[model samples]
Target: MRVRLVEGASLPSYADGIRQVYADVFSEPPWNEDPSAGDRYVERLAADAARPGFTAALALGEGAVGGFATQGTVGFATAWTTPDVFPSGRSYGHVAEALGPDRVEGWLCGALEVDELAVSPDARGAGLGAALLSAVTEAAPDGRCWLLTSVHAEATLRFYRRAGWHQVPVSVPGRAGLVVLLGPGHPAARP
Candidate 1:
């Protein structure tokens, strides 16, 4: 399926479908985010969209998005450039604590940071997730991009690996709860 790249200016037009996909995908398994999580995401998305380099990837299937990517699978992805100074909100702090200041600065700061990528449960195994992921990070500066995912999600970890993301080998210390993955073309990801 084709994944359309929606710039921040046009993201509001796709909010409803994106929220539905977010709720559908995250409400299950390792994420277990509640219905309210979608609400929170919508609110946060506005601020996130305002950030520099904000981009959203939508896989609109006729049945899923009502028109766009509407051939099959309903999946969406979002990403933005990591600020020169890392963020403190959401799980950013946990990531900072886990990787510490040095690695966080060297590997993540200024890189493209994928905030979310969700595919409806019914759409699993259809490759929509990967398509959505590629849509967002395909144009990263120098291919410097990264994201964090739950260590608990084995399949997700596998998916990233298959997509050529290299998992950074760092133990999640204390409450620092995430596994960091560098994109295929990230400079550091190269041998």
Candidate 2:
């Protein structure tokens, strides 16, 4: 499998693949109830990738798109100050809090907040997701990387835990518990 960075404008090309991945991975309450949510999620992701300081990566195998990961700068100031550009909804509030004000500055030096990571159903268990995430983690500035995941996603939670992310004492409304994962070499400092 090959993993590489992709542009916002190119996101549309993988819409179907992403949707398939979402459907297969999130086919339960909260996520399943909202059918259109998948499309909206992708749309928001594409828009977020278009913003400054945002980047996206895609993984391909056997001549087909298999997975994707997105990352961007995050912090209290960025959330509270730039809601228009990147809304801080209840779900993302925990992310903003985890990043805090101190880490926002580090963002200029390589700190990045992972926005999304998904692998097509056909690609799961093939290490594509991990490879895509590792690609983003390695590309982050200052080796700082962070992300949030639903607490109810046992499989996803397990995957992240195995990937080195620790449980954070933060929760999102209407979803599940959230956690943040940092790169191995990131300086140990409060967000």
Candidate 3:
């Protein structure tokens, strides 16, 4: 599959397909998110696209976007800088504590944050997810990138590990099942 890195501002053209994939992938077990969640995601996506450093990769197949990965520099005057908007409220706090108060915003704001990665259920196992993941994070400032996922999604956890992502051990309050994964060059990576 050819993965195209769509600048966030240009993502509106692919919005419908991305929303369909988001609804399809997240509606299943482990996520079991409501279909309406796709609507909310689309709403947030529109806002995220306008922020600085916003980048999204779209997996193209049969003239449609089969999967997508959205990312941007954290704390870049986007809604993402606000912790309460996330599905897991404590994720921001966890990363903050793990990186320490003085360095938390500095580090995160300078690093690339993968906000969402999803492949349509019908499009899984085709490497679209991996391709999108790689393409989306390839331009991180300071070579750092990070994301959070549900620990209960064993397949997703395994996939990230297989792709060389390291899971951060920090515990997130009110989100015991969440796991933070850092890209290879992230400061928290093990030696």
> Which number leads on TM-score?
1
- Which residue segments of model 2 deviate by more than 4 Å? 28-33, 63-87, 95-110, 169-175, 189-191
Better of 1 and 2 by lDDT: 1
Model 2, 144-178: lDDT tens digits are 66666666677877887787765545443444556
Predicted structure 3: lDDT: 0.67
lDDT of 1 by residue, 56-168 (tens): 88887765442333443377889999999999877888789888999889889999999999887666676788889989998899999999888888889999999999998
Question: In terms of lDDT, which candidate is strongest?
Answer: 1
Task: Go through the candidates in order and give each one's C-alpha lDDT.
Answer: 0.83, 0.56, 0.67
Candidate 3 residue pairs in backbone clash: none
lDDT of 2 at 112: 64
Candidate 1 vs candidate 3: which has greater lDDT? 1
RMSD to truth, every model: 3.1, 7.3, 6.3
At residue 191, what lDDT does model 2 achieve? 46
Model 3, 1-191: lDDT tens per residue? Answer: 56777766776666677777778778998989998897888888897787556777787665323354433211111112222222224367666655566545544556777888887665567677788888878777666777878888999899999889998776644554777788877766848
- TM-score (all chains, Cα) for each model: 0.89, 0.69, 0.80
